[model samples]
Target: MATKHEILSEIDTNFPEYLTFLQTFIRAASPSPPGDTTEAASIVFDFLSSHGISAETIAPQPHMPNIVTDFDGGDRSGPRVVLNGHIDTYPVGNPDEWKHGGPYSGYNDGLQIHGRGGVDMKAGTAASTIAYILLKKRAQKLKGSVALTVASDEETGGKWGTRYLLEQGGKASPWRGDCVINGEPGGLQSIRFGEKGTLRLTFTIRTKGANGAYTQLSRGANIIAAQLIQRLLEIESMTPHLSEELRKHFDSSEVRLVANEIMGPGTAEILLAPTINIGTIRGGFKVNVIPEECVFEADVRLPIGLLAEEVMDHVYSILKDFPEASVSKQEAPSNPANYCSIDHPFAKHIADTTEHITGRRPVQLAGLGGTDCKFYRYLGIPAYVIGPSPRSMGASGEAVDIAEFKALIKIHTLAIWDYLGSNA
Candidate 1:
C-alpha cells in the first residue's frame, strides 16, 4: 500500500494542472438543454486530448455528444473498466442563492471550487478525469483497459447521452468495458450501491358543465379541483415500509417525525411503498364561468423491485375513494435498483484501498436519487457511485475536502492496479 505521504506527494505534483483544467470546465455553462451539448462536450474532449490521452468525440446528435478515451492494459484482452460521468448540470437556480459571482463564474473561493456544477457533479467529473490520467501514467502495462466516458444530457433523462450511446451500441465503442463506475456525488467516503426507480404520472379531472351562460357560482371546475387536490395530497402522503437501507441512514426520531409530518400519516410505511409528488396543478379557465377541467402532474420515486403497475394501483386506490376522479394518463420509465455486496471481491478491494489511503473505512450507501448507473446496470453491468466530497454536501455548501480528493486518487489508482495486477 502506498503511504499517505506518497499519495499526498503525487496529488501535489498533479494538483496545479488538475485545478486549472477543472476551473476551465467549471467556466463552461454546460446545462442540459434538450439535445444540446456541443460546446461543453468539445471542451472536455479537448482537455483530454491536451493531456496526451487519445480521445474521441462521438456526437450522436447535434446537441448531445459523448467523449470516450481509453488505455489498453498491455495485451488489451483482459477485463475492461469504464469511468463514467455527465458533463451537464441543472440550470443555476436563483443566482441570488450564490455566495460568489454567477453560478458559472468558476470562482475559486480560496478553499473550494464554487459554481453550479462545481459540487453536484463537475467535481466528480474532474476527479475521475485526473485519476484516470494518473492511473494511465503510473500503471502502464496492466492486462486490461481503462475507459473514460464523459457524456452529456444527464441533467435531463440522458436520452441523448447514455441512452443514445447504448442504442447506437455503446458496448461497441472503443475501450468499452465490462463494468462501469459513475462519478456521481457520493461524498468520496461511501460507495453508493444502488438507486430508487422513478415514475411520472399526470392526472386530469373534469367537472360537469354549469347551467349558466354569464355567471355560474357552483358549476365550476373548482369543486372537482378541490376534491382532486385533497385526494392527490392523500396519495402523496401515503408512506410505505422504507427499505432497511433508508431507515439505517435516517435513524433519528426528529428526522422520522419530520418525514411523517410532511408526508402525512403512514408516510414511513408508504416510503417502503411508492413515493409520490404532485408537482404541478392548474385549473380554472374563467372567473365568471366555472371551468370544467382541472389537471395535475405528479412525480413518484419508487424503491427497487417495485413495479410501476403496483404504484399506479396505489394511485387508483386513492382516487377510487373519490368516484368523480379520472386518472387520464401516466408513464413510468423505471430503472431497477442495482447493488454490489460490500463483501464482493472488487468492493472489498475498493474499501480496503479507501481505508488505506484515508485512514477511514468506507460505509456502504444507498442512492436516495437516481443516475445513469441505472442504464449500465440494466445492461447487466454492475455499477457503483463514488466521488470527492467528504460528507453529504453536494449542491449544498462545504467544499470537496482536499484530503479526500488525494485519498480518492490513491484508492482508485490502487483499486485499478489491483484489478489489472499492474504493480507486477
Candidate 2:
C-alpha cells in the first residue's frame, strides 16, 4: 500500500505533466451559452485513453459531451466515489477587456495560468482527471471504484449536463455513485458542503403613457420600477433558519475565523441571510417620454435551511405595497438550498486529508454560489467542493496561481485516495 506521502511524492515528481494537462485544458475554449464541450471532452478522452484508462463521451445535445470513466476497486461491495467538474465556462464578454491575455490564451508565466476557464473550473477538471489516473494505478489495492464525470452546461445552469446525467429518470444512467467530490474552485481553505438556492424573478410595471411635459398627471412606470428595487433590497435583511448542527459549526471560533480569511470580513452574515441582486432592467424608449412599460429582473439566493416558497412569500408580502408592479418567476433555473452535514464521513475525511496536506484545517460552510454539486445533493448523495480560490472567475484577467493549482491537485489526489482507501 502506498502511503499518503508516497502518493504525494509521486504527484510532485510528475507535477510538470499535470501542469501541461491544465494548460492544454485551458487552451480549449468551452464557454457556456453556446456550450460546445466536444473539443474539451475530446481532449479529456484522449488523455485518459493514453494512460490506459477507458472513457466514453456521452452527449445528450449536439456538441455538449460529458466524459465518464471509472476504475474498479478490489472490493466490489465498497462505496463508489465520483470525481466531478464542469467543462463549460462563463463566456468571456470582450476579448479586448482582457489586460493579460485573450480568453483562451492559456498564458502561463511559470507562476499562474491565465484564461477564462483556468480557475473557474478547467484547472479543477484537469486535477480530477490526473487524480483519477493516479487512483486507477492503485485500484488493485483499493476497496471502491472512482468514477470521473467531466460535465458540460454548468455556467448557464446544468439542465442538459449533470441534471440529465443524474436525474433524467433513465434506467441505465451512468452517474450513479455513492458520493461525489466536485472540484469547483471553492478554495483550499474551505470544503463547501452546501450551496444557496436560486429564485430569479422579473418584475414588470405598466402604466398609462403620457407626454414628457405632463407632470403629476401620468403614472410613470419607471417610478414603480424604482420602488420595486427598494423592496427587493430589503430581502437582504431577512434572516434564515440554520440547522442546529450548522449553527453550531458557524458559531465555532475556528470556522468564523477561517470564513473571514477565505471569504472576507462580514461573509458570515452574508451566508446567514437571503441575498438579492437586481441583475437587469429595461424601460423607456426615450429619455423624454413617460414610459408606459418597464421591466427589471431580480436574482434571489436562499440560504441553506430556507425554502424558496418562504422567500417567495416574503417577496409577495413586500409587493403588496407596490400594487402597480407585477412580478413573475422567470424561466431562469432554480433549486432549493442544498446541504450535507459537516459531520458526514466523507466530509470529515476530506477535511482531515486537507489538514494533513496544507497544515491548515479547512472550514465547512455553505457556498455562496451554485455548482453542479447541487444535482448530486438532490439525489441524496453527499457532495463536497475543494479547489483553488479563483483570482478571477468570470471577469477579465482570469487566472489561477500555478502554485495553488498544483497544491489543489495534491489535495484532491490525497483526499480521493484517503476516502476510497479507508475500506481497504
Candidate 3:
C-alpha cells in the first residue's frame, strides 16, 4: 500500500506534463486507409529516445512503421508482460463536421480533450507509454520484464506493425509475452477480457452489359448485388454457443451494465449474435446503361465462441444461387473471437487494481469490435483491454474525459506494478 501511494503521488504530480504529451500526440494525425504513420512513429520514437529508452522501428510497409522497446525487471525469471498500442487512427471524414477546433485540434475544454485519435486510442496508447516509462523509472528490483510495442497499421489490421514483430523471431519472439495488455477504448468500468472478431469482405456481381431498355439481353448486375445482400443478412441469425456459466456471468447486473454502457445499448444482443453491416454499394454509371458490375463492402462481426470459417461457410452456401456473384475477404488475415478467462491473473490484476483505486469494481465483458489484442489471443496468449470510454471513436468530435484518462494511467501503472513487483 505504501508503494502504491508513492506511485500514485508521482503520477498525480507528473500528470500535467503527461497531458501535454497526449495533446502533442493527438496533434500528430496518423489516419489509416492512407495508412501512413511515419510522423506519429517518429514522434513516439523521439519521445522515448528523449527519455533514454532505446527503441527499434520496423517499416516493411514503408509508410506504416512500428516502434518496439523492452526493459527487464530485477529478475529475469518473472513473467513477461507485453504492452501494446497503435499509432494509426480511423480516418477523419469531413473536417467541417468536427468540433472543438476541428478533429486534429487536441483542444482541452477543461472537462475533455477533443480530437481525432484520443478516443479510438492515441490516449490509451499514451497511458501505456507513460506507464512503461514510470515503471522503468522505478528501477526496482523486481522479477521478469515488460516490453512495449507502439505499432502502426492496427487500424487497417496490423500487417506491418504488431503482427510483423510477433511473426519475426519464432517461439521466443520479440513481442511474445506471458500475456498482453492493450489500452483500447472500452471505458474504465468495463474491463474487456475478450473481443468480437471481424470478417471484412467485398461482394461483387458481374453480367454482360446492355442498354437500359435492353435488359432482356443481359441480367442487371445491380439486381444480383441487392439479392445477395438480402441473403447475407441471414447470417445475422447465427448465435454462438456460449457456456451457461458465461451467460450467467453476463446476466449479472454488474456485467450487463458495463457491457451495454461501455459498448452502447443493445451490446449484449450484438455480442452474442453475429451482426452484419452493408457499408457501401456501387453499380451502374448512368441511367441509360444497364449495370454490368456491382460491388458492395460488408463488415460481419462474430461473437466469442464463433469462428470466421463458420461464417465463411455460411456465406458460400448463400452464394450458391448466383453464379455471377462472388465474395472475397480483405487481404489482412481474419481472426476468430478470442478471450482468456476473467479469472486469469493478468485480468484480475487490472480489475482488482482498478477497484482498489476507484473503490468500484470493474465488470468483465466483451467489446463489440476487434482490436490488436485478438492477434495475441489467436496465438494462445491472453490479452486484456481496459481504457477510457470511447465517446466518439471513428467519428467527428471525438473526446476523452480528463478524469477518466487520468484514472487510466494510474490503474495501468499500479496493476503492472502489482503484477511484477509481487514476484520480487
Candidate 4:
C-alpha cells in the first residue's frame, strides 16, 4: 500500500537533506522566553544520534533541555508512537516587524522557509524529523516503539516542556505512548479535532482612603471602582452564555463572521460571549485629594463547557452590588476543553489523514489558542492536532513549504501505518 507516488518519490530523494536540516534547525536561536533550548536541543540530539536513533537530553532544570529520542521497531511491546515538538518560540515579535529578514534568519526564497520557528514550529520540527526517517525506512517490520519528542515550554504553559515530561516519569519512561502526535502548526490541511478551553482570570479593584482630603468629599472608594468597571461591562456582557458545546461553537456563520471581525459589531453580538479584559489599571497614588484608590485588572476568558466555578459564580453574581468590591483569581481557573468526538477513531484517523493528503477539507476550527492539548486533556490523552502549516503560513513574509516539506514526509509515513494497525 505504498503508492502515494511511492511516498512522494521517497520524500523527493530526501529533499536536499531535509532543507539542510531545516536550515541548521532554524538557525538554532531557540526562543522560549529565554527558556533557551540547549542549542536547539543539541540539533535534535545530533540529528537523532546520526540516524541510528537513541538520543537523550531530558533536562528538568539545567536550562532548556527536553530532547528525548528513540527508534525501535518490531515488538518493543507493540503500539507506541510519540512525536511531539516545540523547540520554543513566540518572542521574535518585532525584529522590525520583519517581512523578510530577522530573528535567527533561516531564510530560503526557493519557495519559502523563512524564520521564527518558521511557521510557528520550525516546520513541526522538520516534519517530525523527516517522519522518523521515513518511518525507520519503510516500516522495517513495524510493531511498536517510536518517539521523537523535542519539546520545551510550549510557548509558555508547559512550565518547561510537557510539564517537565509529566514531572519526570517522562510519560512513564520508555517514551510511553499508545498514540501521541503533536507537530503543532496544524495547517498542513487539518487534523486538530479539538481545542478551546483556556481560563485566565484577573480581577483586581481597590479604592479607599485619603491623600489630601476634601476637594469635594464624595469618594466612597473611588465611587466603588467606577461602579465595578461598569459592572465588568455587564459581566462582560452577560456571562452565563455559552451552552452545549460552547453554544454550537459560537453559532457558526463562519463563527459569526469571525466573531464580527474580532469583537466588534456591538461586542460581537454578545453571542454566547465569554472573554473580557480591562487588562490593567493603577490606583491614584497622587493628583490631589479624594485620590483614595482605583485599581483594576480583568482578563477573563472561558468557552468550552464554561466552568471555572461557573466563571467565578458569574463573577460573584456581577459583583453582588459591590460590598466594597474585591475579587482575585489571576489564573487559577482552567477548563481545557476540546472534547474529541467526530466519531473518534482518533477522530477518523485524523480526518481521513487530512483528506488523504490535502485536497482540502481540514478546517474544523476551535483551538482558538492553547495547546499541549491542554496537558493532554489533563492526561486522559486523546489529544489532536496535525502539522506543516502553509496558507501564506503565518504571514509577515513567513514561510516553510518546500512542497509542504515533502507533503509532511508523505503524510507522516502514511500516518504511521494508518495509526499503528500496521499490516506492513
Candidate 5:
C-alpha cells in the first residue's frame, strides 16, 4: 500500500503533465450564453479514455456535452465520492480588455496560468480530472468508488448541466455519490460549505400607450423604472437573521480575521444580508419615445436562514409604493439557500488535509456566488468546494497562481484518499 506521502510525491513528480492538461483545457473555449462545450468535453473525454478510465459524453442539448466516468474499487461497501467540475466559463467581453493575452490564450508566465477560465474553473477542473486518474491507478487499495462529472452550463445557471444529470429521472443519472466535492475556486485558505440562493425577477411597468411625439399626455414607463431602481437599492441596507451556527462563527475573532484575509473587509456583514443587484433594464425604443412597457431585472441573493418567500414578501412591500410595478413568481428563477455543516466529517477531512499539506487550517465560509454544489445539496448529498484563489474569475486578465494550483491538487488528492480509504 502506498502512503499518502508517497502519493503526494507522485503528484509532485507528475505536476508538469497536470499543468499541461490544465493549459489544454483552458485553450478549449466553452463560454456560456451560446454555451457549446463539445470541444472542451472532447478534451476531457479523450484524456480520461487514454488513461484507461472509462467515460461517456451525455448531452441533453446539441453542442453541450457532459462527461461522466467512475472508478470502482474492490470493496463496494464503503462510501462513494463524487468529484465534479463545470466546463463552461463566463464569456470574454473584449479581447482588447485583457492585459495578459486573449481569453483563450492559456498563457503561462512561470508563476500563473493566464486565461478567462484559469482561475474560475479550468484549473480546478484539471485538478479533479488528474486526481481521479491518479486514484484509479490505486483503485485496488481503496474501499469505495470515485465518480467524475465534468458538467457544462453552470455559469448562466446549471439547469442543463449538473441539475439535469442529477434530476433527469433515471437510475443511470451518473450522479450517485454519498458526498460531492466541487472544484470551484474558493481560495486555498477556505472551504465553502454553503452558498446563498439566487432569485432573479423582472419587473415590468406598463403605462397607457402613447406616441413618441405626445410627451405631456403619456405616463412615461422609463420614469417609473428609474424610481423602482432607487427603491430596489434600499434592500441592501436591510439585514436578515443569520443561522446560529453562522452567527457563532461570525462572532469569532479568528474566523473574522481569516475571512478578511480570504474575501475582503466586512465579510461577516455581507453574509448576513440579502444582496440585490439591478442587472438589466430595457424600456424606451428611442430618446423621445415614452414606451408603453418598461422591464427591469433584479438579481436577489438570499442568505442562509432566509427563505425566498420572506424575501419576496419584503420585495412586495417595497413594490406597494409603486402600484405600476408587479412581479410574477412563475417568471422568476429562484432557488432556496443550501448548506452543509462545517462539522460534517467530510468537510473536516478536507480541512485536515489542507492543514497537513500546507500547514494552515482552512476557514469554513459561505460562498457568495452560486455553484453546481447547490444541486448536490438539494439531493441530500453533502457537497464542499475547495480550490485555488480566484484572482480574476470573471475579469479580463483571469489567472490562477501556479503555486496555489499545485497546492490545490495535492490537497484534493490527499483528501479524497483520506475520505474514501477510511471505513469510518
Candidate 6:
C-alpha cells in the first residue's frame, strides 16, 4: 500500500501542472441546456490520450458524449471502484451577471479557481483525471481496478450519461463496480451518503383569447397559471415519512452541524423535506391582449423518506381545483431518494482517508440536492460524495479553493489506494 505522505508529496511536486490542467478543462465549458459536451469531452479524452492512457467515447446522442477509462489491477478479484464526475454544468443563464470575464473564464488568483462549472464539478472531474492517471500507473501493484466515467448529462438528469453507461451490456458492464465515488460538490464538510430526488412538472393552461376590455367573457390563461404556482407551494408543507434510521441519522448533533455549516442555517431540519420552485413561468403573449396560453414548470424535489408519487398525489389533489391547468409533461428521469449506510466499507474508507489527510473527519449526511450518485445508489451500490465546497454553484462567481482542489485529488487517490489494498 502507498503511504499517505508519499501520495501527498508526489501530488505536491506536480500540483501546479494539475491546477493548469483543471483551468484548461474549465475553459472548454460544457453547458447542459444546449447539452453539447463535445468540446469539453474532447479535452478529457485528449488529456488522457496524451498521457498514453486509453479511453473510449460513448454518445447515445451525438451532442452529449461520455468519456470512459477502464483498467484492471494485477488482482482483478478485489473490489472495483468507479470515480464519477459530470463535465456539463447548469447553463450560464445571463452572461452579464458574471463579473470576472463571464462564466467560462477559468480564472485563477493563486487562492481559488473561478468558473461556472469549477464549483459545480469541472474541478472535481479534473481531479478525477489526475487520480486516474496516478492509479493507472500503479495498476500492476494494486488489487481490483479504477474506472473513470466523466459524464455529460447530469445537469438535466443524465438521460445520455451515467445512466446510459449502466445500461450498456455491449461493454459487459465495465462501468458497473463494487462502489462508486462521485465528485459532486458536497462542501467537503460531509461525505454525502445520499441525496434527495427531483420531480419536475410542466403545466400548460390554455384559454380563448379576448381583448383586455372583454375580461368578463373569459379569464386569461395567465390568471390560472398564477393560481397554480401558489398551489405548488403546498408541496413544501408535505412532511417526510422517513424510516427511523434516516430520521435518527439527520437528528444527530454532528450531522446537523455539518449540514448547517455546509449549506446554510436551518438546512439540517429540511434535509429530508420537500422544496418547491416554480422555475419557469411563461405566459401572456402581450401586455394589452388577454393571453391565449400559458405554460409553467415546477420543480418539486422530494426528500429521502418521501416518494415522488406522494408528492404527485398532493399535486394532483391541488390540480383538481384548477382544471384549467393540467400537467403537460413530467420528468420521470428522477430515481427515488437513495442512500448507503454511513458505516458501509467504501463510505468509511472515504471518511477515514479524508480525515487522515485533512485532519477533520467528515460527518455523514444526505445532500439537499441531486447528483449522479443516486443512479448508483438506486442499483444497490454504495455511492459516496466528497469534494470542495459549492461556493456560488449555480450562480455567478462559481469557484473552488485551489488548496481544496488539490486536497480532493489526494484524498480520492489515497482512499482508493487504501481500499483496494485492504483485506476487506
Highest TM-score scorer: 2
Residue-pair clashes, model 6: 1
- For model 6, residues 1-424, the per-residue Cα lDDT tens digits are 3455666788999998888888888889788888899999999998899889999999999989999988999898899999999989888888888766888888887798888899889888888888999888778767998999999899888879998998788336888898988878987778998888878788899888999789887688998788778778888888988778778878989888888888989998788788878877788867889998998887777888888888888878988888777884475555677788778887888888899879999998888788998888888888999999975788778888998999899888888988888332
**TM-score for each candidate, following the candidate numbering:** 0.82, 0.96, 0.94, 0.35, 0.94, 0.93
* True-structure lDDT of candidate 3: 0.86
**Which candidate tops lDDT?**
3
TM-score of 1: 0.82
Listed per candidate, the RMSD to the true structure in angstroms reads: 4.8, 1.7, 1.9, 18.2, 2.3, 2.3
lDDT (Cα, tens digit) per residue for candidate 2, span 1-424: 3466677888899998888888888888888878988888888889998899888787889789888888788776778889899899988789997755577888888788888898889988888888889888878777778899898999888887888788755635557688888778778889999989998888999887888888587768998888778877878887778768778887788877767777678877777778888878898998788999999988888888778888788888988887778889865477788987677878888888789778888888778899999988887889999988844788788898888787777777777777776433
Model 3, which residues run further than 4 Å from truth?
214-219, 422-424
Task: List the candidate 5 regions with Cα displacement exceeding 4 Å.
Answer: 99-101, 169-174, 209-219, 237-241, 330-333, 422-424
User: What C-alpha lDDT do the candidate models reach, one value each?
Assistant: 0.66, 0.83, 0.86, 0.65, 0.83, 0.85
Positional deviation of 381 in candidate 4, in angstroms? Answer: 21
- 233-343 per-residue lDDT for model 1 (tens digits): 554444445558556654555444533543346544443445667777787766656667777777777765566676678778878766556775443354444554444
Candidate 3 residue-wise lDDT, 1-424, digit = tens: 6767878998899899889888888998899879888988887888888889999888888898888898888777888999899999999879999887888899999998999989888888999998888888765555789999998988877878888889888687968899888889988887888988888899899999889899788769998888888999999998787899887886787777777777678876676888989999989999888899999999898888788888999999988998999999985746678877888888888989899878888888888888898888888888899888875788788888888888989988888888886532
Better of 2 and 5 by TM-score: 2
Q: List ranges where model 6 is wrong by over 4 Å.
A: 97-100, 207-209, 213-216, 422-424
- Order of quality (TM-score): 2, 3, 5, 6, 1, 4
Instruction: Please give the TM-score that candidate 2 achieves against the real structure.
Output: 0.96
Which residue segments of model 4 deviate by more than 4 Å?
17-101, 107-114, 117-192, 198-209, 212-281, 285-295, 299-305, 312-314, 321-337, 342-348, 351-384, 388-409, 412-424
